[model samples]
Target: MVSGGINEILRAVEFILSKLLSELQSEDENDVEPKTKVRLIVPNGSCGGIICKGCATIRSFIEKSQAGIKISPQDNNYYGLNDRLVTLTGTLDDNKCFNT
Candidate 1:
């Protein structure tokens, strides 16, 4: 037989546990985000072809891109240049926040 105070405490604990479990479950369902690949579409002018002539300009554009891109600090390699395709990898959102 439980005393009144102990019974009240147990009930409160059970209620808190139930609430926590529900919250966890809900978060699990809604917290998943899809990560995909994003590529740069170099326009015509000096930024076309496999070996782009405007490599510096393209690099500068990506460095200053409004899209939130997660780039490696050690990654200073030029992409879309010398017939090479460089890809940036990370999870991005509509706001362009890239995860490093």
Candidate 2:
């Protein structure tokens, strides 16, 4: 049961990230300012129980949280589709994530 719950959380995180990236990529280039915020929230309760669970379960969640899109600042890559979306979506350091 614990493993399944963790999997769901991992998937949720990925879905949120993907949406953020997509939103960042659809902005107008001529605009002077981007107006969007990207936030990810992982509840403390999700990570609270079952310390004795298998290593695979723990590792999977950790890996998913660390997963992120990599953007290149050169070649105007920062203005690329995904990059723009990310910019409009704010950042991971915004109010999306919290450590409990």
**Top-TM-score candidate index:** 2
The list of candidate 1 runs beyond 4 A from truth reads: 1-4, 30-100
Give per-residue lDDT, candidate 1, residue 71: 27
User: What TM-score goes with each of the models?
Assistant: 0.26, 0.29
Per-residue error (Å), model 2, residue 73: 33
Query: What's model 1's overall lDDT?
Result: 0.42
Residue range with the least summed lDDT across 10 consecutive positions in model 1: 91-100
Q: Which segments of candidate 2 are over 4 A away from where they belong?
A: 1-4, 29-100
The TM-score of predicted model 1 comes to 0.26
Model 2 whole-model lDDT (C-alpha atoms): 0.40
